[model samples]
Target: MNHQERTHAVLSASGAHRWLLCTPSARLEEQFPDTTSDAAREGTLAHELAEMKLRHYFQTKEFGKRKYNAEVKKLKTEELWQDEMDGYTEIYKDYIKTLALSFPAEPYSAIEKRVDFSQYVPDGFGTADCILLSGNTLHVIDLKYGKGVPVSAEENPQMMLYALGAYQAYSFLYDIRSIHLVIIQPRLDSISEWECPLGELLEFAEYVKDRAKLAINGEGEFCPGEKQCRFCRAKAQCRARAEENVKLAFNPDKGKLPPLISNKEMGKYLAYGEDVAKWLSDLKEHALKECLAGREVPGWKAVEGRGSRDWTDMDAAFEVLKEKGIAEEILYEKKALTLAQVEKTIGKKDFAEMVGGMVVKNPGKPTLVKESDKREAITNKITAEKAFQEEQ
Candidate 1:
């Protein structure tokens, strides 16, 4: 796996949108350490694999080095490697190859390139996965290994910042007129793109400059919202976030529900419901951690739960079961895994090739959801049914 290097800047492009929204958070976050989760590790592994494939295909000898080979060997053994990862990286690599040849002149291509935006933001720098620079345009492509959330390219600050940084790195030699940002999310079968003129890009740079100044000086308000607090390290303790979540209930008393819940009220809940659920889970995790570390919480305590028994020797256990004349039905239970899980294991394309005709989806049931959700909502009532008249 390509190990995630510790970030040096207080504000990198990855968190620019968040810090831009809550400037003080940039300062506050410095007090805490970086926390790498399993998902992040998986993402790094996926990127490493993608980079390796590109290096090989592009005929770069760097991937043949001992360092790269050792990391690749280590990463491939981990559980994150899947058949689907191959398909995702192929899509990303193929796009980069196509984008390189799309323009009139042969565009210069760089993989896993470091970009600096320190001119606009204090110590601002990031590593863009793939950058293609041509005469009057540049194509910046990013691979998102995540499947839960589909990343969009429309007005995306991270991509915009990457473009700005790339422009800073290459504009002296190339007269760039337009910038293109592409987000490739193969897991979700999505490739979103956006383009902007050089004028608009400069305008955004001005906005980023102002925000960066405030963020560096540690002099901005803590206005909590869903996007800002989604990844904040101090989210649980932030008063603004707590207040926003508390506003969801007129009264959270156990005895009775809120007196009113019209469509307007329901709208607020739907919008903020995911954030509230995340807060609850975060609070529980925090309390459990504290208790495990010898700190006491007011109303909660951790206790061991009932666990199933296991045999010391599987062969002996099987022999004993046979000796007892136990039926196979009692000895084992059978259940099939879902297609989604199998697809992820085998890769999306291969899963279809292997089991395309074997599966069918049932019509979905109606459910209330945010407008942002990809799926269309099914209405509860079908209005104005036509009545049939008897034919002559």
Candidate 2:
């Protein structure tokens, strides 16, 4: 499968849910720089790996065994490559093969196919990880690499957009009457699929068209909630989000309440519990950044949180321990307690008397805390070392 470099649109299909729900976020997010996380890098690597294997499976002639082996070797050499990724990619490949077999005949396959849905979403386009078109069916498969959340294909705007794009691109060649949207999240051991008639898909496109116009023009309401805001770049400082969470946390307008909270109200509160916590965390992170940038964030300041310790030289440090008559077994067991855990178990006094001389402490990383926090306020000159092997 040939890979296509993904170029994100202002209203990209991947962020369809966010933009569709919080229509103004697309413009709001443009204020912040795009950033990638370690997890996202790993997911990209996983996609590369999965694409290589699937290309080999579907286009065996063009992507032969020797070429496939070379690609696999190159992918395995990636810094973020994990041993478990091999199994996960294999799971994805096997699922695709199984899906193809279920079709009446050999399906036409495309890997990392770029699809344009500009008709519905202005300048919208996204890469379909895999597309299998056969007879009357159009299948759009998406490989989700993250285990943190299990994405479903049922009415998933991202999957729907991809399916729409595939249909627009292939319906002329194939008598496509039905559409299948698939989410293969192997890490979560889930394979969710949603199928619909071509007519229903067209209706979905119309719905998207209405929202896309609002999103592209930045004319829609700033509806702030969890799902839509999860990946929004502007989430941390969005006034709408702050206001919504504030209301959720303290619905003072409810005035007087019953002695006991009603079950219905409790359920509603519980539903937004994670969202409220996440918003507060994001608020603190935003304020911390402002303070670090030399801006005054009224009641908060940055200070040293906690630092991890590590050995400058593991072998030399262990040698010192051996000289101190400490056996190797006591010092290792999947490398035993994380310093603090060990100290707590052995009693801090005993730990200090026994092994304290062998270890050195490092100051914690810069952190944001209340102005009244007892810890002394310090500049952002923090550092870190290997957690269990700090140099003495």
Considering every candidate listed, which one attains the maximal lDDT? 2
Writing each residue's lDDT as its tens digit, candidate 1 over 210-285 gives 9999999888898777788888888876777777777753434356567878788677667767687777777788
Q: TM-scores for all candidates?
A: 0.85, 0.82
Query: Where is model 1 more than 4 Å wrong at Cα?
Result: 1-3, 6-8, 59-75, 251-260, 272-274, 333-337, 341-349, 357-361, 380-392
lDDT comparing candidate 2 with the true structure = 0.86
lDDT of each: 0.81, 0.86
Clashing residue pairs in candidate 2, if any? 1-55, 306-364, 307-364, 310-389, 310-390, 311-389, 311-390
| Whole-model lDDT, model 1 | 0.81
lDDT of 1 at 383: 38
Please give, for residues 1-392, the per-residue lDDT of candidate 2 as tens digits.
Answer: 33324569999988998999999999999999998888988999899989888888888898999999998898888888776777778888998999899888898999999899999999999899999988898999999999886677888899889998898898778999999899998877888888999899899899999999999998889999888988899999999998899887887435676788787776666776768999988888988999889999988899888999998999999999999999999888874569867765665557789999998878888875435344689764444544334553
Error of 1 at 318 (Å): 3.3
Model 1 lowest lDDT segment of ten: 383-392
